[model samples]
Target: MKRSTSNQEVKKLNRNRVFRYVNSREETSMPEISAALSISGPTVLKIVNELKEEKLIREVGEFESTGGRKAKAIAAVRDVKYAIGLDITKNHVGIVYTDLSGKALKHERVRKPFKYTQTYLHEVAAIVRRFVEESRIPKKRILGMGISVPAIIDVQRDYITNSHALGIYDVPCEELTACMPYPCELLNDANAAAITESNRSRTCSNLVYLFLSNTVGGAIIFGNETGIVRTAQEKDRGSVYMYKGNNWRSGEFGHMVIHPEGKRCYCGKIGCLDAYCSALRLADQTDGDLERFFREMEAGNQDLKKIWNEYLKDLAIAVDNLRMCFDCEIVLGGYVGSSMEPYIQEFRNLVAEKDIFENSGDYVYVCQYQQEASALGAAIFQIEKFIDTI
Candidate 1:
């Protein structure tokens, strides 16, 4: 059965939609918001006044005349609140900060290996405090912080279920955030990175992001995040919702078996995609330095070239499988993906050979944001949630 909303609910929804429109654009007019959102002119006027009183938006100058008195130009006060994002990997921590514009204002990476202990958690919290202090952003202006971890995060339960790379399972969410100064939330690193990828376009899109890091990871993005509330089944909040499965373990693309009875995977499975396509497989050849591996390959190192050729063959299999299942854009992201531009065409040719529905591999793409994407995406989650409240 479908549920109906109250009059107050409808009004709030309309107000939120109106504010989102203003925030999304550089500047918009009252008449433009009315027509664009299908709200009455008086209703837009009232909402504009309400937002102005709340100081979430400001009326700046006016638009050119259209055979009538000029309309006030309204824009969102993007700096009213800010958010910080933390990306937790096996051996490094990536941090990024963003405002309403949803772009990373600044980011930094620190080398910090994972350690399961209360003391480590406290140190991580201190790291955030130091970063914020260095940035000189007022504490009051910060809304909250989002932590992107390499694990299956139960957003509703607020706990981490499993993280192969981190060597932990079923950890309480508080262990990592209990010592933080500001409110913090957890997100799967790949899912968080996908949000950053989608935000790159500044438009809603349905796509799948294939994260090629130490351990392979993936995430799915539904088309509409800020769209009107049409269904009661919406799970993850704000502009980008993840398709977490029944066990909250969707997009586990790494476990897919590409070559049965072949090489063993770290998860004790044979021939899982992770065993074949993880960036580590190639980086391991160059003493764990992925950049050096690429540089050596570009300089025509025959041994590295042989390894890359085999790696791309395996990557093509995974890329083709993702395309077949999602039928949307497949983005290669993470450590190795940052360096894939030089060989994407060659890899695409391999994917095209396996694809039955399409002969072109144009759908396969390299990710936009690199190491900072997960952290930035995690911060955007808080930013979008703040926008929803307005």
Candidate 2:
């Protein structure tokens, strides 16, 4: 019985390995998979046949023959499985449908103020159902759904511990999941963006992602996975961290006190990073129009440019502090980060002025996905789970 169990486990591992290899490559032959994974040709052929029978993979074409007979190539059926992602923020709700490869097949956005009321929950459910129905993909094909929010999540309890942006706390997961048909998961908005970025590229393994939207948030990536960095004191922390003692708020970087006697934040704090770095702060400079603010700055509006320069100065201080603590690449993301692409060089220069060691722009990078990252990342979380189960 022991030997039988071991054999079964080995077979399952090899099957998953072959499936992953084929999914990663554009197209591959049985011989190629065998060589890459160091599995025997016969075993590779058997797994390939099994995957084909399961409709997970299909023969795409035949590889060119160097000599003798040509080899048949196989590729993963990307649409065989799907997942849904939803991002809920203070001002908008974004929805996305993604395949196994994390490609967004369909997406929709609606403007609505977030509320923890039952009416809001029902509205969210309606939007998700509408998106699924319009996608034209069979419901069963969608493995699960992931919900992203700008708040601290207690994964063990499946609850939102606290979210200053939404002004809600201790909300049960069922409040949102009960309205949906598929299985649902709750994730931090910044963490979701990091997951999406990690799935998009494997180039940088260790890094920090700063989410600068209406509320400032962040995540740390170590060895190609999201992780938490421990700090001795709350004052000496970044945007995200594990709570120590009775403290429920740990990684809230936006709430970190930057100016001991600066502007007041919505969290009833003065001189916080959020007060200086959030997109809402920028919009306030131009009568609540961020676009107009940037437009004026671009047109040589000295007053607006001066306001931007001050904002950059404060931002540089916060970014430099984080860089010194983490000693890894920093990724700027969210609505504000996407817009900063045009002025990335300028921002880098400001950061360089504050850094004593590394003055190069190589340490900082703009995110690949702009506004869609959080929603797409949420969907990707579900897709990853589905893949693991398979």
Measured against the true structure, the TM-scores of the candidates, in listed sequence, are: 0.93, 0.87
Predictions in order: lDDT = 0.87, 0.80
lDDT of 1 by residue, 88-187 (tens): 8899888889999988999999999989987888888888999999998888999999999999988778789999989889988988888888999999
- Backbone atom clashes (below 3 Å) for every candidate: 0, 4
**True lDDT of residue 225, candidate 1:** 47
Q: How displaced is residue 378 in candidate 2, in Å?
A: 1.0
Compute the lDDT of residue 302 as modeled in candidate 1: 95
Give the Cα error of residue 141 in candidate 2, in Å.
1.0
Query: After superposition, which runs of candidate 2 have C-alpha atoms over 4 Å from their true positions?
Result: 1-10, 35-40, 224-250
Error of 2 at 222 (Å): 1.8
**In candidate 2, what are the lDDT values of residues 24-127, reduced to their tens digit?**
77899998988978889999999999899989999999999999899998999989888999999987899998997876777888998998888998888898
State candidate 1's TM-score: 0.93
